[model samples]
Target: MTDLTDRVKQAAAAAEADSPPPVTDLAVTDTALHWLQSRQSYFTDALPRHVDQAHFMSVALSIMPALVKCTHESVHTAFLACARFGLEPDGRQAAVIPYGDKATFQPMYQGYIELMYRHPRVDSVHFGWVRERDQWDYTPTEPSPRDFFHKPRVDLTEDERGPVILAYAFAWIDGKRSQVIILNRAQAEQIRNKYSGAYKKAERNAKRDSAWHTDFDAMWAKSAIRRLVKVVPTSHELAELLKADDDADDTTTAPPVIRGTVIRNDDQADNADNRTTWPAAAEPGSGATADTDGGEQA
Candidate 1:
């Protein structure tokens, strides 16, 4: 009887050792691993090499805690899906790189569009980059002001019409239909200038910057989606996901989770009333403005 018991215990221990540990305590398993492998395989011939299994796993594991903090859930199948969409928990905002470089895996503009459609209240999300003519032609009606002090305004004048735009607007049709629009001339001009400089600088590899300049719509879409999602009230699950995003932008070297971009905030920058002054030529007739109270206009 004693011999039989010892043999059973040894068998159990051996089986346990042979099996792999859970990917994370929250929930990833064979399914997530298999899914990742399949995705990596699908992108085999793509220009920028897809992230290897090891790098993906590293980011996924590091982001799990922030996931828990945001949603009270751990690593799970949905989290895997989220990670697959370029939303990394390691604090790397979508870093754009040249073809040969290790491209940053952050949320794609398209991914955010899909996410908005999935929301119960959001009926549509529209994003675009437009010149004066297009922006003027399709200018949306302004919302009525709720505050007594602020009066409603009229359409843009001929002089004000030509301002370049990176527009992000959405419609909600839950009960009473409503809409929100955000136009960020500041970011639009900033991104344009950066890309234009890159285009001019890259003599040998001009194609990359040229493509970037031509793809202004996508650039605007990405910025719009990032800003809009942060402003809108979402469910706890989505909010938790965004918390990871928020943490990634933290400048502190010793942040709790992984961080990709480091923004050093000075005393002035941290204040709510202070406008961020970018060191560049200001656009004519442009100033920091907000549509919603206590929210960024751009």
Candidate 2:
């Protein structure tokens, strides 16, 4: 027998020795493998890709009591029950990606973050440096302990569906997450467009979670930040005033800005997806103040 088989046998024997006669021991076999595979496919394929990972598994497992109660239900009926599961407070707070070509794997990350903590969106992930010593200090004495200090080992969920994942991490896992989502390009694009600059999801093979790689980080650091950049700290009047005060004597270049578009014609700008070009300076009161570049007319 293989070492794994031997290990299973020894483990089973130990369990039997420690437990009361009434308790059952798990047996490993081909039949067990087949059952596991079938259960896994049902949970995974039943849901729409739009569903985040947490809700997907939760919905799938909720049917177990039904499966247990109605053992006679056809396997097809049992499988369909997962898709039909309804969540109250519809669309509560999904970290939805815009439907687009680029966001194919966004939901996986959304699910991953949701699985770890109930954050509202990917933009809200709090990432910062942690000292190596601090990390070591938190290590537990045993592996896979229930304590948070142990840090979770990414693994298959109890429902047999795949573990929640992030596109960042999926790179290290050989694009499995992308492969899963790419099955529906429409769904993937929807996510990609919304989170266009949200993640550094590269076309290259994914090798890890988080954009630790130079190219990976570069994408988010530049593009994502442009998206993340909130409205310029103050309105144009305040911004211009602050600029004048700070550079009372200096004549250096201006601060970088993500957005500075200001359209005076509310009606035209509101209806148009187009942006009006601004000159360094427009004729005074032309309702064109592009010249006062404290950022933009906006």
Candidate 3:
């Protein structure tokens, strides 16, 4: 057999023979290192290191399960971002929700946009967040001319003349038509409440932190975009990679990471400040919208 194949078999045998009781202590074999190296093209940022030896072990344990339920390609793509975002690995997908938290596992804004356009039928996807103007506004980005025919529309509606924190827009298309949906501060909170177990730890901190209180617009936008991809005509592969998110941490159904295992300034720590905080706008002097190439958007 080829050297690489032989190395992988040897590593698997070692893992099976001495599988440590602490999942986090499992080694990152040469095979996994090779896998990570081979998938570099799929990522944009440098992948974050494991928070500790335990975190590395958890990642090692995750590899086999990811490969089994998620196809090799799917697990590879999911890990590309998971490593970057320091997300906990689920079966086919990865979790953004901190261990034992109740809010859904939403991706970082950049990851959210990337997964959207990764949809084969998706011509393009753009994101906007609430601004200081007492209305929801987004960066005014134009899709490529080829996509102008079915550009997704983003806008807000009025209820009683007061700022409608809740807004709906046509954010996605199935290559056939568009889908209008609602994304608002209320919905995000509702989601958090629905997955209350996951937020129990964060909710206590949110009461003290202005960061969480002030960033609802960006948070709502991400929540909306994540929901949009699942309901639309994305690739089956992309969908499978994200499917585990539907009821993340709501029950014992999820794969476990090191729960109650705290590391100071831990990369996996769920602090609001350490989390994905959205900037007020994507660019200065640009309209309320942020344009990104499936990466960071305003």
Scored by lDDT, the top model is: 3
Q: What order do you get sorting by lDDT, best first?
A: 3, 1, 2
TM-score of each: 0.36, 0.18, 0.38
lDDT: which is higher, 2 or 3?
3
The reply for model 1, stretches above 4 Å from the true place, is 1-103, 135-164, 175-179, 188-219, 230-233, 246-298
**lDDT of all predictions, in order shown?**
0.40, 0.27, 0.41
Q: After superposition, how far is residue 148 of candidate 3 from its true place, in Å?
A: 16
Query: Which model is ahead, 1 or 2, in terms of TM-score?
Result: 1
Native-vs-model 3 lDDT? Answer: 0.41
Q: For model 1, give the 10-residue run with minimal summed lDDT.
A: 144-153
Task: List the candidates ranked by TM-score, beginning with the highest.
Answer: 3, 1, 2
Model 3, C-alpha of 193: deviation from truth (Å): 0.9
- Candidate 2 lDDT tens digits, 1-298: 1236656777788788995332222232232233323344443544446556465555434333222212111222323322322111112211111111110111122222232222122223322212222221222343322211312323533234322222211111221111111112233344344543322343233522222232332332222222222221223333332232222112132221112322122212232212212112222244543322212262
What would you estimate as the lDDT of candidate 2? 0.27
Between which residue pairs do clashes occur in model 1? 86-106, 90-258, 91-260
For candidate 1, what is the TM-score? 0.36
**What is the lDDT for 122 in model 3?**
74
Candidate 1 residue-wise lDDT at 193: 55
Q: Residues 64-131, candidate 1, lDDT per residue (tens digit)? A: 33232221111222233344343433433233222221121234566555556556887666554454
